[model samples]
Target: MARKKTITKLQILNAAYEVVRTEGFGGFTARNIAKKMKCSTQPIYLEFKNMDDLKNELFEKIKNYLKQEVYSNEHTGDALLDACINYIQFADKEKVLFRALYIENHLGIEKMHKISLDFAMRLMEENEDTKNLSKEDKFELFTKIWIVAQGIASLISSGLLPMNEEDIESNLRDALSDMILGARYSK
Candidate 1:
């Protein structure tokens, strides 16, 4: 008798991640994941208590993926600048995932905001340019840059704006410089 292949929870999660990555959260269902995994939904249900439980775990996984893969670029030696560039690139490259997370709010808006803020603050803490900034100043700077970066990312992801790498980097650099100067002078 041939042994039946057992599907693990990690396998189900990976399948689910691919579904979300390709089709956004709207396609994030057990059936869809099962189709991707070439398995039945029974394995998914057996591994996770419920779809909500799977979704909650998936959300955490997505968050970590974004933090580690999407926003950890160090190309420019400037943490904030690199993060902004990586975010915009991710938005452009992973349009479906970006829309599901930010445009459609599949990820809770407040949680996403907090995650972005926390990540920015951590980068700022490590940056010499922002290392000595007071908490208020840091917040102000982060808000300003985040707004600009988000706007650019939204436009690019929506296909309303077509920008090359140089233009994107230049615009973000200008915005970062302006925000930093404003924060410093306002103190």
Candidate 2:
């Protein structure tokens, strides 16, 4: 009979996620995860076909983390702007992981862009002002806000700028207002 597994697949994935969280994808390896898990790499290979499979799982976990944890910040009336702040805060906090996912392109640009777009759409749906916007306008305004947020995130994550909450709020508020007004005029 086949032996029952000891280390769970989730445990392995979690270990890998932690590694990537602290060290980025460059440190992703069986040996690294094994060190983190305090176990042999055998369980890792047994659970996943290869590093790519493990990475794919990690990516999904990251997505869920973003939705359920990062974006679930305390509501402050302006849910859309709060969501942008949450995203930038996440980047500031998880610099290595953010750099890996966004800057290093280790997670693939297309997937990240789609995920960001989807998250923005969900936030828009929750906002009273944006909830009724047409798809084109929503996409246009969201794209603009996302661009600004991403720039701020990238700068903060890369240490180009300090993680100043006031600065983030100011930049995002100005951009959000300008984008909304521009959309109104163009409409």
Candidate 3:
């Protein structure tokens, strides 16, 4: 008799991610994950206490993946603009996953928004031009940028816009400039 293969936690989590990537959170299920892994649901249950446990772990992994890949962009002299472009590019590339994460709120929109805000603040600190801004100002700028970036990302992800990189950068710059002006006036 052939021995059954042992599925590791990482293997199960990876398979789950693949399921979410292709089928979105709507399709995230132990059966689907097992199918992706070409295994039975027993392996998934063995690796995770339940679907919720697997889902939480997969959410963490997805966040890390987004931070390292989607949100992490090579600096183009302007760190904020680079981040915006990278975000839009991520939507373009991972349309379904992006929709799941941001559009469908499968991973909890509030948590994702907090993660995005934190990342934006980190980028703000890295930029010499805006590094000295007060915390409140930093937040204002981040919020403005996030609103615009998310809007563009949604449009691109939903097939509503065929946004070119240059156009995205231009829009980001405009939004940044407007936000700076508004912040200065309001202060």
> Which has the greatest lDDT?
1
Q: Which window of ten consecutive residues has the lowest lDDT sum in model 2? A: 71-80
TM-score of 2: 0.93
lDDT value, candidate 1, whole model: 0.90
Of the two candidates 1 and 3, the one with more favorable lDDT, higher being better, is: 1
After superposition on all C-alphas, the RMSD of every candidate to the true structure, in Å, is: 1.9, 1.6, 2.1
Model 1 Cα lDDT, one tens digit per residue, 105-153: 9879888878789999998889877878999889988889889999999
Candidate 3 lDDT score relative to the true structure: 0.85
How accurate locally, in lDDT, is each candidate? 0.90, 0.87, 0.85
The best-first sequence of candidates by TM-score reads 1, 2, 3
RMSD of 3: 2.1
Give TM per candidate: 0.94, 0.93, 0.92
TM-score of 3: 0.92
In the range 87-179, model 3's lDDT, one tens digit per residue, is 889888999898998999988999888888888899888876677788999998888888888999989888898867788888888888788
